[model samples]
Target chain A: MALTRNESAPLFSSDTANTLRLIAYLALAIALMVIDHRNGWLVQVRYFASAAVEPMYRLAALPSRLARSAGDAMSDRARLNTRNAELERELLLAQARLNRLQSVRDQNERLQQLLEAQRSLDLGVQLARIIDVDTDPFRHRVTIDAGARQGVAVGEAVLDAHGVMGQIVEVLPNTSTVMLITDPAHALPVKSERTGLRAIARGNGALDSLELQNVPISADIKPGDMLVTSGLGGHFPAGFPVGTIGSIRNDASGMFAVATVTPSAALDRSGEVLILHNLPDPVGPPAPAPAEGPPAESAPANKAPNP
Target chain B: MNRLRANDWLFWGSIAACYLLQLMPLPQAMLPLKPWWLALVLMYWTLEAPDYVSLGRAFVLGLVGDVFSGDLLGEQALRLCVFCFILLRFRARLRFFPMWQQALAVLALLLNDRIVLLAIRAADGQLVPAASYWLAPFVGMLAWPWVFLLLDDARARLRVRDA
Candidate 1:
């Protein structure tokens, strides 16, 4: 048998053709980027495409999944027993803490009833396991095994056991993409747990740091002050832990203060998360009290109905 | 001819492996250091068997890469297109270079890809990446020789010769 020689031809037939193809492909790519960045026009396209590719992601995740299970199975009995004991003790401690908070919650509810204020609604929460973390260095996103079919909607708040993790940004049929609070584009309205001074916490493209925007230098907030969602935007429920202020300094213009905050959530490591549902719409400025007898000022008297 | 029947299968299989390597979950600290495995593999095929790699293929693969990596839709597509176009232009010289020189050339190519990424990010109004962001190309450069040799061996075994 005659040996066949390897023949590796050039990819393009000619220089002109190469240049033309490159220009065309580049133009298409730029157009896609612009369309994707400008709006949600490509969201459906992405959803369908991701649905088709979901199996590939699962296959890629298989090794890690197997390893995790194998590690779980191979753990020594003594270590498991010790871990069980540790968890039991932690549960007991949490129960004790809950007992104290339970009375305070009851008193607060009673106070609300007496005042005739809108009853605080309890949002539903669902647990989702993080299936994959984005490999792109610039993006801090993860794919959770919950999606539209599971009634996971965009904009739902996600949290780990410790604090707010992020919000759902896109939902495919079987999986959803969650944008971490540490993403550069994300911002959360938060208030100082110590002083109640409201501020916006903006992600600075780092997993460990969030910058509080437009903070006042004279504000009572300081290092170590805990921040919690203010529920002003209605995206996140009120009082969820966000982060702790790390350092504060005046900006370049000295017009406003900037405080760097270390996020409280495990932005890099959480394997499981809780997604909050049934968040109420932004309850626009509270209706003026009827007792004040200012009937003319309360133009929009009808309260927005809660779903 | 009978042996070459599996050529297409092997080619796609290699591409699949590269994608898996790229999408495999990595620790946060190691993410920036993850080399562009798909690029390296594509470069090898383009140099050794350009019949299997083309500009269109590169663009399509990059688009899929973007989806898998969760980047802006066309970001990786553009990056891979530029990468492939450059590789095609210099294939004659690059194919004949000694292993070390070829590795350096690959480094330059990966560095160019990084610059393209930087421009894309800048256009998207993202902040400048950290210094560690530039580290992946060096890692890719170091891995180039081994990748080339490995794929070369695989190609020879698969008998991907001209008809």
Candidate 2:
């Protein structure tokens, strides 16, 4: 009845073959990590792995989603009536705002044509619900229900009602991974709504604040200045609310100021997001190229000299 | 024949259950406390049933772990393979340790695993993780006695003699 290994001679030992195998596996692992980081040739492998693991996430999310639907079903009539009234009032307000926006949109289109700019059609978006959040402490990311199958491409801007959320970093078959604006690896092209002082906001691995580096202390930026996507780098569309400046700390060297900004979006919460499927203009006419923000680069611009 | 097959199915079934548990979401505050369920389970099998859980098997499962956790492909494979190697080397002594001592052994193993994780993360240019990231191994240590007891009870109740 004893279920132990019954070999008369112990089969477990520090054998040469095991050591060789260990060395081989370690080499393979390091090679894989290096290759995946630099070349990305193993993207197909990641896609396959993501497809395999997505079902597990779905299974895990099923319980909470079911409970939510159950709660929705069990809500009483009085609550429903109050909610309906609230929604109707909200709808009326939105419709009224839309009526005014219609005229502004038409006038903007006419102005865009006068500037001889490429089609400045409105940005389009698709809705997708977040399914799971990344558990790694170093990275801030989420998995959404939409992917390449839904024509959701990588680098597409994802958003919530509050502000620019992040971008689609990975596109799997049925689910895509989104890197949040708070991830240490992400940076956004933003400009001051007041003075158009362009700056790059890089996430510092802290959810509450992002650091705007290398802006000279004399730069025309201040606390409470709303930052909208300047559309300079063209990663995100123009005019999306990004964040508000929190504090400006003068560096010890006094060469530049580092300002921390709290993101406008409630990034820590899980909910539906709008994926900007089409950006309004892919390119702009050449000029002083002031219309061009920073070129799209993986890293934030280290320096932008003011003339 | 059918009765013998049930035991094999049960072993794989428990593995699948553990995999699912590893996938389960914990609240953000509790993230650092979530034990490495897969590593613990792998350790359990390597300790109790060395025949089925070989170094190669450990490597493959580690690869699966890398994929499941969305890490680089070989990261878990390397970690698991090294852990399995050590477990295999020490299985003769570990198989006979009392439950309390077994828990100590698990604590030691998990602490070592954390060092490996640190090394891997450092290679990836990540800064030192939050203090709580180191707490997971101790969490696994606390869960070990219960996990061992539960699995042993299931193994006994099933009345499946070892091959």
Candidate 3:
């Protein structure tokens, strides 16, 4: 306000003041960014600021939402009936598949009981619609309509109907930002379904692919091998599909192999996602006895056993 | 005093519109083509009304943008401060330039802003951006002329009504 008051005083002083202010603000910004990136202590500041702008996001999304509803309301009766029939058939098929899964899950529960293993938690999922996409071209993030008010918390894994999408990074009162598995900064622990080979799948900043890090040259990985969450990290539950290995090639170092993974989730297209809650802690305390059994059956009661 | 207040309302209102435009959803294919709407609008005000648009104000506006975008705090602030500083330094000459030349200058400024963004990304250890990453500055450059005329018309109308 003082600066505005003095606007017409003189030009010479203003120019010098401009440069001085630029330097001061630049220093402040750099410090804020360094502190923000390193420790994320500035999240509280962002949390409050984002709350103030929440209505702007809604306003921006208003037109598309209206148009979608209008289009839905205008659909003809015949087309609607066909869509209804198709959805009913799809629901029947899904119910059949769920019945099969129910039996398999029951069997698995029995097996876990026999082995005295902690049963996997029955996680809850809240459905949320994508409200906005990140403006930054490099970062793969999206804002969802559900947030802290809806019991959404930071670090909750998000998934579509098909597979794992990403994890919640920031939770506001009525909105949250989900960092997709394709963000260059994200890394997920995944295992091959066939070989149980564990590797860290790092996002390459591309929506279509992830890269498996530090795989050994002789690792039993092949193209098309399904990758699932290993549950080594307590953030995500086990047996959720992450991606499929696309290609494997030796790294330039020749000692390790790098493989690209095609993410199973429709990262760019999915509008609705389920935010998982109450994830099971699969990585229990270290085992006591060194069992000389096969790795497949060795960690039954200890770390996460195959689903 | 009433006239000044009205002009001030226009100034802040236009800036708010720019923020809305930035936040508006675009198809994934059209995302890289979305020009830097905030920067373009800020450049207009900083040029036409230097008294109202200062470096400190620009920095704060960018901080707001950073918060809204969920980017690293102060990232946009630094970029916008540098942008405002440059525009202020060259404001006199830039004000006299023809429309086409001014658009070219806008292009250069937007490109410089991209470099600032690239430096920040590099410092943050982000992955190298894809080729489409370079397309936004050009889009901003092309959008500059229309944006300038539109805002200039709006300001002229505001001044006429105030008079």
Query: What interface RMSD does every candidate have?
Result: 3.5, 3.2, 2.9
Q: What lDDT tens digits, residue by residue, belong to model 1 across residues A1-307?
A: 2123345244332352288899999999999999999985777777878765688778877887888789999999999999999988887876666655566556755776787754333345677888865666677888898888888999998887677888998888888889999898899999999989999999888899999978877889889999988777767767778999999999999999999999988888748787777434347654333212221111111110100
Cα miss at B107, model 3 (Å)?
0.9
Sliding window of 10 residues with minimal summed lDDT for model 2 chain A: A298-307
TM-score to native of every candidate shown: 0.86, 0.83, 0.85
- lDDT: which is higher, 1 or 3? 3
lDDT of 2 by residue, A1-307 (tens): 3244335334444452277788787788788888877877676887877767788778766766777689899999999999999988877876666656666556755776788764333344678888854535457788899988898988998888678899998888888889999888799999898999999999887777888999988998889999988887767867678899999998778899999999998787777887876543435554524233222220111101100
Pull out the clashing pairs in model 2: A232-A293
Using TM-score as the yardstick, the better of models 1 and 2 is 1
* Cα lDDT of model 3 by residue, A1-307, tens digit: 4345535533343473367788899999999999999999888887777657788888877776777789899989999999999988887877766666667667866786787754332345677889865556668888899988899999998887667899999988899989999899999999999999999999997789999979998889999999988877767767778999999998998889999999998898737777877544347763422111121232122221111
Could you give candidate 1's per-residue lDDT for residues B42-161 as a string of tens digits? Answer: 989877777667899999999888777766889999999999988888887788889999899989999999999999899998888889989999999999999998888876876645
C-alpha lDDT values of all predictions? 0.79, 0.75, 0.80
Lowest lDDT block of 10, candidate 3 chain A: A298-307
lDDT ranking from best candidate downward: 3, 1, 2
